[model samples]
Target: SFSGPVTDHAASDDCGVAILGAEPDKFWHDHKGAKVNAIRTRTLISKADIIVVRFGEKYRQWNAAFDAGMASALNIPLIVMHLDEHQHALKEVDAAALATTRTPEQVVQILTYVIKGTLPV
Candidate 1:
């Protein structure tokens, strides 16, 4: 979950978040680790209705970019969260986001609007 009070906005019935990456025991520095990472990322992307990407320095990594690409290829609704001003490969992804946000609160609000299909302007 987002760890916020999104209920007030009627977020969604399925408001769950999954963090996909390497475990502490496995780092993404070898061929085996890379394969595992790719498979996990692909599975998560395939299952997600909407994929939220935190754009920053870490997103510059190839695996992170690959995940975004997979989400794009699958035609999932992708939201690019600009956690910081740092440039990342998310911008290179061809899929246009439904919206972009700079803060967690904004992210929740955007998710609410996206899932609900309406926003109280």
Candidate 2:
């Protein structure tokens, strides 16, 4: 991995989004089932090779820690990037995260190198 060492399971087949696959932000909220999406998100989080939570200033209600907690709960690799001021007090759970970066490009580079064994030129 580009950022740091992670578990072997962090490079599994079930990853969060294959870079350009789908918009991870609002696909669930835009859909019909909130309850179903919660379950699905849980299942996905459980199996994901990595969990990335981008902290932006716009959405006050988006629970980044909840997702981070889920990732930490599953012992999954986590990458957090804070573009805003609110960093919560998750303590050791936050320390357990693989990396906390500022740029999405860094996250992408790390994931690409981890998954594809190459860096973007």
Candidate 3:
């Protein structure tokens, strides 16, 4: 039931991807608790070459805020995809993304550019 911008990107295998918040704790409590999960999350971000910030229709403020902060603090490259066009006006959702996009394809393209060092990512 993957909808929105991730439909195509998830279907393709362009890069090694780490889908943040995709794992549901109710079904698979691998991390055990929030503290462990948070530490694991920081490790993941620190290890990643780039981070993708996908802001959907109903913005998950906590995830967005935390993930974005982690990426910034870790100096990981980031690409932000505002699935909808009006996310910039949200005001409350604050993220210092290197670049902004409206689709998964754009996010991928931006990633490519970042990897190539031709674009600010």
Candidate 4:
């Protein structure tokens, strides 16, 4: 499952509209059963060859650490995108091993290159 803070934009969607204003625990319990029964769900995680993480201002350190851990555990390539102001923390992870992008479009471009095996690395 893709876990992240729900944004206002998501709340306007059909599924989100239904879950709007519901308690967090209630939502979790409601979805738990179906989440367990899906076979393709496991494949979703394992089949991801690359994980692109967007690190904005709110949770920079936490998101970066989480992405790093997930990438390491799953053995998938990880690309971290952040503002130029936060470039210093990029060294906290593997500089040469991680792909960096400064914008959302750049993140996509980086992932495309990585998937195509053309990224410098």
Candidate 5:
């Protein structure tokens, strides 16, 4: 859950977001930890209705790009969030995305609209 009105969306039976990732102890440097993360990623991608990826310098290590690829391969709708500076590096991923947005709020608005047919005011 995303806190605040994210619950409102849930209460209305409109939408809910699951932020998936490794636990703090499951860092990728550990071999067993990496396997666990791979399973988690595969499971989430297989089950997700929509997947959102936010990219940046620090995010490169998180393999957001790899997750985005899985999202595409699974035919799940994808939304990529990144700034203009990174646009060149991410154009191909964005091309595969249903939408490329700038802010977290925009992602929420897009989700709300897609799932409920109600645009943010």
Candidate 6:
């Protein structure tokens, strides 16, 4: 999650914001650490209002499924950014609940709009 105050559109002021990312330590660490990190990341995602996931060949693991599940269970918006040339199977995600793209800047813009209440669903 984002670790600082962000501009909240609801109040039109700065509010504590959290940008929830999934299983970072798992993706970068060994098996022993991945399990623990997955749990921690899931916990964070369950508590967040928005979840941003980078989808590509690099994240072909099942962690992405876990993140998607968390977002679905919470009924929060899930933003998937495709950064690579490889096509991914997005069938597990709910089309109505997900926002997908191929750029980091698009993700940032969407997040900013979400925080500012300017995004059109």
Q: Write one digit per residue (lDDT tens) for candidate 6, span 1-121.
A: 4621112333211111112322345343344344445556667776787887666465333666666677777887888766445343664563634687778888888887878768544
Query: Each model's TM-score?
Result: 0.60, 0.59, 0.57, 0.51, 0.73, 0.59
- Model 6 TM-score, 2 decimals: 0.59
Off by over 4 Å in 2: 1-34, 60-62, 87-93, 119-121
Q: Is candidate 4 or candidate 6 better by lDDT?
A: 6
Task: Order the numbered candidates by lDDT, best leading.
Answer: 5, 2, 6, 3, 4, 1
Flag regions of model 5 displaced more than 4 Å.
Answer: 1-29, 60-62
The 0-to-1 C-alpha lDDT of every candidate, in the order given, reads 0.56, 0.62, 0.57, 0.56, 0.71, 0.58
Tell me the lDDT of model 1 at 30: 42
For model 5, the local distance difference test gives: 0.71
- lDDT, candidate 1, 15-80, per-residue tens: 221133324442323444445444555766787888876655552345445656677778888776
Model 3, position 53, has a per-residue lDDT of 68
Give the C-alpha lDDT of model 3.
0.57
lDDT of 3 by residue, 1-121 (tens): 1112223333322222233344554434333334444555666777777777676666354566678777877777666766455575633333566776777878767766756757544
Lowest summed lDDT window (length 10), candidate 5: 9-18
Give the residue spans of candidate 3 off by over 4 A. Answer: 1-32, 84-86, 89-95, 116-121
Q: Tens-digit lDDT track for model 2 on 10-60?
A: 332223333224345565333333343455568777768888876566552
Model 3: ten consecutive residues of lowest lDDT: 1-10
Off by over 4 Å in 1: 1-29, 58-60, 87-90, 116-121
